[model samples]
Target: MGGAVSAVAISSILIANRGEIACRIIRTARGLGLRTIAVYSEADRGAPHAVMADEAVMIGPAPVGESYLRSDRIIEAAQATRADAIHPGYGFLSENEAFAEAVDNAGLVFIGPPAKAIYLMGNKAEAKRRMLAAGVPCVPGYEGDDQDDLAFAEAAQDIGYPVMVKAAAGGGGRGMRLVDEAGELADALGLARSEAASAFGSDELILEKAVLRPRHVEIQVFADKHGNFIHLGERDCSVQRRHQKVIEEAPCPVMTEDLRAAMGSAAVDAAKAVDYRGAGTVEFLLDAAGDFYFLEMNTRLQVEHPVTEMITGLDLVAMQIAVAQGEELPLRQDDLKLNGHAIEARLYAEDPSRDYLPATGRIDLWRPAAGEGVRVDAGVATGMEVSPYYDPMLAKVIAWGETRDVARTRLVRALKESALLGPTTNSSFLVDILQRDAFIHGEATTAFLDEFYTGGFVADEPGGADVALAAALLLDDDRDAAFAAAGYVSATQLGWSSAPLSPIPLHLTTDRGVFDIGAECLGAVWSVTVGDDLFAVALGQRTDHAVRARINGRTIDAVAAISGSDIGLSVSGKCFRFHRARPGMEDDAAGSSGRVVAPMPGLVVDILVKKGQKVARGDALAVLEAMKMQHQIAAPIDGVVTGIDASKGDQLASGDLMIDIGDAAE
Candidate 1:
């Protein structure tokens, strides 16, 4: 470890990020009686982070570049608030060396590793060099600072047929490409370089050997200025989509005591090489033969830290603060004990099967499960709008139990009890991941999603007739045309009316199929009959932001959410997310925006065209990335790029811009 600092604690702490992570840190700081301040963009004026902090400061507009990325404003806010420490939550300026340096020069505690450590690890190539020097196993490839595509591709070919071209400036699967052959090397390297250039403002790249069907395993390491450091075991983050980790669990199923000891010692050595401090993670790709290679080290708390906390019964955030306050590590390497198993599932505001497109809308029902061994770290609430200006991650649902199976069961049960009503989400898909035979058998890998997910997504997807029955029963209100004791039809309007009664039409949409049917409600129970099928449902108490409805005679569980004029129901083994019928027929399937649509709420980072510009398919037309990640919106086909919309920085929503096309054949 590095030399000890004089002291680390300060009077107050300024959180340098927003959303659920901000809220999560606030809770920890408040529990420790440490004053906390929150910073937000315009779109997050009423966001969860602002409401949870002791002090809230308005930064800039919704665009991250204008708000979160502006390190000058953040430092100003910290000084203005008299905050002596700055806690950069994961994302934004967390790994930014310059930001850390500015904070240190301002005579404030950075509450993380030293600026030099951040600088060294902030660059992938340099970190790999440090790791190799520390005798930590690294991928058998090149980490030299090389920007030449041909040179890097040649090196990649030397590493063998399958290799990964990655951004040397950052990690999280961004700026990463998997090349299978020499012919595919150029395109992969170029794309990786461009994405890296846009996201991290650095096009520098490194080449590495791709572990065939490797499992992503990372070790949680912590160090203090007192020259004490230890490892908190490992987490398996193998389940991923588009290179983004989705499901993470502690005490990997394939983990062995010998392997853990070997990797743990190596991780400790790596941290020591950087003289690291505070909470950080050393990630690795573990192959089938028990061999592992250093992937990258996250110099900040990971999104899956709660899983580590659950298994160890340790408040990692509190520990981080204590260490930053100059406290020495209390436990030795041998004293660190691993107990139960824990798992975390990321709840995102997106449609999983619809290319995992980010979504935006008002959260009508925000229900998260809270029980023993189940914890929810969430940012938004009921009535909150999921803005396009931020990450689609709404919350993280973590569960703990004595055994892995128990933990998985608890997580699935907790998720089933949650009801988040907004735009289409990935709740059902998360459940599917948990219940998959391979996932259950501990056979998960980075390509697990690629093997499972097919295409497209429908909201409230209840795929079978059983789901339809459950939905119908939940909405039943016992309607009849015959006269009742009040001398009028029971299904008629509340006020006296002489007009002839007509059948009431109700629509139900889910991931399964859309249903246009009739319904009736009777006290706590509802009955609905579609065609020859009769259904009955008993409503349960409101749990979270959803209404649990039990279908009579069906063992399948169901949930229904009422948002505005729309009702989304998940029943049987399927789901249906649909809107209330309007004047025109609905298109169940829409085009994939072959031209270009804003993937998330973001600003046009750059515009590279004007009207009548000829462009081919896959050409970089415009760039629109939200939540700090850069997305290159490319052209879909050969056509004239007609009608340029905005300038360098214009905020946009999905489908907000349309590039006109005359030749449909193109």
Candidate 2:
């Protein structure tokens, strides 16, 4: 670590990152009476960071390669703004040793560890070797420097099946695959290596034994230039999807006082070996036997640091600033105490049922849940696009309670009330995983994602009720209501409506069906029946295109919008009605024909077909760029394109029809 003598007074600190991290750092800096400078790429000019900081600098164009990753431009921004220090708030150039050195050479304090410490722990293979030498327990697998496929496969087999093939430079869960069988190892290796190479610019990987039934528990480590270090307890990150963590909680479900001390000591040892300073995370894999193994150290602050803060009641960013100012860590291991448990769920613009593909769109209606144990750390607000230039994560929703179960349940409740409309999100997926029996019973593991979630839906999910309700009632409440009026004993209004009408036949919603059991207007109150169920109903004032009804013994708010003679209930939340209609209720719009809809809001990457080309159902039609990734838009069914409304390089938002696939075969 740097041995520079410094004082706490700093005019302003420049954040070298963008999005949520930039906003987060600025908020903390403001809290401590420090002025903040935010640098932005063209893509993030309208982002939260642009407004959060006291001063903003336009670094470069949209691509991170030209802006955020360009360390010289960042340092120059700091110099221009008279920023006394720079905080690399994780990702991008956060862990770049040369960036830190450049900041120091330019006479500005770098709010992280020394460049030498970063270099020492930045390499995965080298980090493991150093940890092993420092008496830290590591997974029993080959950490050899071999790139040959045959040699790597042999090492993987030696480690046995169920080993993990990891890219040495991989983070954020990309370029990593789990191999449960020997026959699958070769394919996994090739894919993992290719992805890793593409992502991190280094395909060189190191094989490691995948600890069976292990929980991901990482310790928050902090150090100062004076050799003072302490662990801020552990965070459980076992709730994951495709090896990417979705939910993380503090004071792990299985962590005990004895185990915490041991793991904390090991993390401290790992940091001391490299003279690590500032905020860093020492990750570990805790097996069912209660033993822990060193699982790489993140040289920068982590995404789930909020959960640790909830338990420890410490501002980690503030601590990083103080440490950067040559101040020793204010607390020792004895002073640390973790109270109330906290849990954090990552809100991504991704569809859960679909391979967790990230989504992009304008957050038309964005409202974060408030009150009672809830905290939202978000980057984008309404109208912000989840662009393809950066991470797909929208926010980190955290809930703190007296117990872990309370936190889990509270988060679930918050998610239930939270409404998001414009774009598809993973909110419903979090609800599904949290409501599962396995999660409630504390059966979390790295394999939990694939185990409970099959490629299909469960026989009876609560989401079905909403979909069914959308199908049965919200679709055609008027004509059907006149028919199904209960206790009528007459066909006065039900006999006809403008034209001679027959009683609408009953159709099932889920297993529940609607029937034309007649209707009677008793004074102001009306009665209707669905099967043998009788309900007293009343009509509220109708808005244009929607009818509201009060039904049964409970008040049911249904938006019945008539699409021709049928109905289209705009059921809000993640469940926007089923992809297919229930049997006979199939309408024209329900069928995927003649329209190429915008999947989400994003920039158009490529448009593959001409206006009159023939296409298949799965043909790559257009590429939509969102949330830092490109998603291919495929044709719905075999058809000729009637219209091409969009072209490559066009800026688009959700629901804008770009292509039309229509009229080939009915």
Among the numbered candidates, top TM-score falls to 1
Off by more than 4 A, model 2: 1-4, 456-553, 556-666
TM-score of each: 0.86, 0.77
Over 1-666, each residue of candidate 1 has an lDDT whose tens digit, in order, gives 556567655668999999888999999899888899999999889888898888989999977789998999999999999998999999888999999999989888887888888888889899998999889999988887556776886787689979888888887777898888999888787677777876777888888888889999999999998889899999999998767789999999999999999999888898989989999999999988999999899899999999888878788888888888898887788887888999999988777775676778877767677898999999988787887767788989999999999999999988877777656678888998999999999999888887766553334434335444444433332233244545664432342334433444566544334566555555444455555565665554444324455666554455556654566555432344555554334444333334455656777877776777787777777767665456667776667765676567787866676454334444
1-666 per-residue lDDT for model 2 (tens digits): 346565666768999988777889999999999999999988887788889899999999976778988899999999999999999988888877889899899999999989988877877888899999999999987778767878878997788877888878757776687888888888677667766664566787888888887899999999987778899999999988767789999878877889999999999999999989899999999888888999888899999999999989999999999888878888988999899999998987777765566665455555667879998888877667666567777888889999979999998877765655445678878888888898877778977887777674232232333433443343235545555675332232242233333333444332123223334445334444444555565555555433455555455554433333343333333424223234366344422576877766667867889977989888988877654445678888888888899988897866798998777752
lDDT of 1: 0.78
By summed lDDT, the worst window of 10 consecutive residues in model 2 runs over 508-517
TM-score of 1: 0.86
